[model samples]
Each structure stands twice: as structure tokens, then as C-alpha cells.
Target: MGNSSSLHLQQEDVQAIQDETGFTPQQIERLYSRFSSLDKAGKSHLTREDFLRIPELAINPLGDRIVHAFFYESKNGEEDKVDFKDFVRVLAHFRPIKKNQEKNKLNTRMEKLHFAFRMYDIDGDDKISKEELLAVLTMMVGQNICPEQLLSIAERTIIEADTDRDNLISFEEFAKVLERTDVEQKMSIRFLS
Candidate 1:
């Protein structure tokens, strides 16, 4: 542990999480192990770099957006880091449960989508503009893409996502973009055995 203070999860905290999330002790321990692995310093905070280094996330299609959301969704200004509580909250969206809780799943998906939208919104305008969308894509693509090609891609994405055609993606529009069953299937996370 880099700093003792950074690691704040007590037994009570574990029990609390179990009580709230209905995760078994084994599952909670698995989550804790993951947190510990990412918290190399044992620091409670998981930085953006730490998140990006995860092999699974690095290859995930929505990895960048999810990383962005992880930071942006922090109640406290986690800045570039997420504490354990926030981490758990984020993971709640992806619990590997066989028994379908349709309402919970839908709500979690919406929350995740909203976080992603905020990540793409750039200026905190509660809406995604073409420029912002382009910037995010550019960040994701780096120097590999030409400006014109990026612009065209952004325009197409906006057109596809902007159902009402207001040229901006509101939460509703963003939800429509991400709400497909296929997308949900792809985004779903499988918990560690």
C-alpha cells in the first residue's frame, strides 16, 4: 500500500456492500482483490492510467468512454482517480447475475449511458456537440486519422445518434444510441469466478 490512508475499506464496509449489493462474501473478496491489484500502492484511489492499463479495458470498444465516465461520475472530484466506494457504484452496473433483474439492469444501463454522455460532453453542457464528439474520437484514434476523415466520422455518428436531428445528442438521444440489445450484450461485464 502506497499510503495506509488510501486503503479505507473495513470489514464493515465489506459487509455493507454485501448487504446493499447482495454480493456473496466470495464475490466481495473478488472485487476487493481486483481493487487491490489496480491499487498497486494499495492506495484506495485508482487512477486513469491504472484503469487504462487493464488489458481487458484496453481492448474494450467503449474503454475510453468508460474510463472517462469513471472519473466524471465520481461524487467527489476524484479528479483522475476513483475511490473504492465510487468503484463499487460503477461496478454495480455490471454485476454477473443469472437471475434477471430487468428493472435494475435497465436503470444501471441508463446510468452508465448518462455517464458516457457526460464524458463526451466536454464543456459540461449536458449535451454532446459534433466538435466534442469529434474531439473524443480524435483522442481515441490519435494521429492515425486525418482531420477530414475524423470530421466525416463525427458527422455520421452525430446523425446516427441525434434522433430528433437537433444536431446535438441529448440524454434521450444518447440512450437511443446505446440502448440496443446488442450493445448492452457487448457492454455487459462478467464478474470473476
Candidate 2:
């Protein structure tokens, strides 16, 4: 198992991750070191518990959803764990879209929106229902607002964004609502080189 982890950190594999994730070699190495430290079992993969154990994430309002997004790409019945490659790939969605960045599909505005959409589309359905939006809103601001106010806010949000009047916010509707907002800048994170 230890050998497998080292294999992924090899030069060739690191290059592949860099290509797919738009992470610099240095960034990949740094993230891999963090991943290693988080993988107390040294299995080259992280479990939900490992992610939840992070002190910052423990108190983050969106922490659970962020953690869920990391495992969203899991396949072959490994839904509970995220390998190093997938971990980096998920993080790639937050890479700032530089004016001269290469054509990295993963870092596009659409991809970033989709990542945010998935947080509200908790059921994995292609649309965000009122209940779904309410659930997310509660997660974010439930502590400050009462239940009635939260539900009202969620309903208003859905009504405003549901352009087709379908009572649910589709991806197109969600995108349209955010059309004026600078998703590129808002979704990006500065990755240390």
C-alpha cells in the first residue's frame, strides 16, 4: 500500500496530475505532502473521518458539502474514500482562471458553477428544489436566522432564480442568475507555487 502512494508521487505521475489539475509541480508536491500527513494510515487515500478531523473544516459552515464534493467522483464502490488524484482534481475547480491560462477545461467558469450547484443539488439530481436550497441555506445561516426566516429566504431565492417557473432551479437558471457575477474571481483560490 505504501508503495502505491509513492508510485503516485513519482515524476511521471506528478506530471500527469499537473496536466489534469492545472497545479504547478511544486503545488502538487505540497498538496501531496499534506495528503500524506492527513492519511494517517498511509493508504494513499483519505477517509471522511480524516477530512472531518481538520479543525478548520470542523467549524466551517460548508465543510460537509466541501468534503462531499471531494468524494463525489469516487467510483467502483469506493465512495467513502478519495485517492490523491481525485483529491487534486476536485481542488482544481478552484484554480483561478488566469487571463493567459492554458485551456484547462476543469478550471472554466462553467465547471466552477457546477461545483457550487452540486452543493445545493444534494440528491445528485440535475435541479435544485426548494427543499434542497433550504437545506443548504440552513447549513450556511441557520445559526443566525430562525427557521421561518430561513425558509422564506430559500423560497425567495428559488423564485427569483427559477426562470422557467418550474419551481426548481436548473443549471441554466442557476447560471443565468449568476451571469452578472464574476464567478471566475469568486470561485478561485490562490494556490501557492
Strongest candidate by TM-score:
2
Where is model 2 more than 4 Å wrong at Cα?
1-8, 75-77
* Residue-level lDDT tens digits of model 2 in 117-157: 99999999899999999999999986899999998998999
Clashing pairs in 1: 1-41, 2-41, 6-44
Worst 10 residues of 1 by lDDT: 1-10
Identify the candidate with maximal lDDT.
Answer: 2
TM-score attained by model 1 = 0.71
Candidate 2, run of 10 with poorest lDDT? 1-10
Residue-wise lDDT of candidate 1 within 141-170, one digit each (tens)? 877899999999999999998888899989
Candidate no. 2 TM-score = 0.92
Error of 1 at 119 (Å): 4.1
Distance (Å) between predicted and true CA of 46, model 2? 0.6
lDDT of 2 at 38: 93
lDDT of 2: 0.86
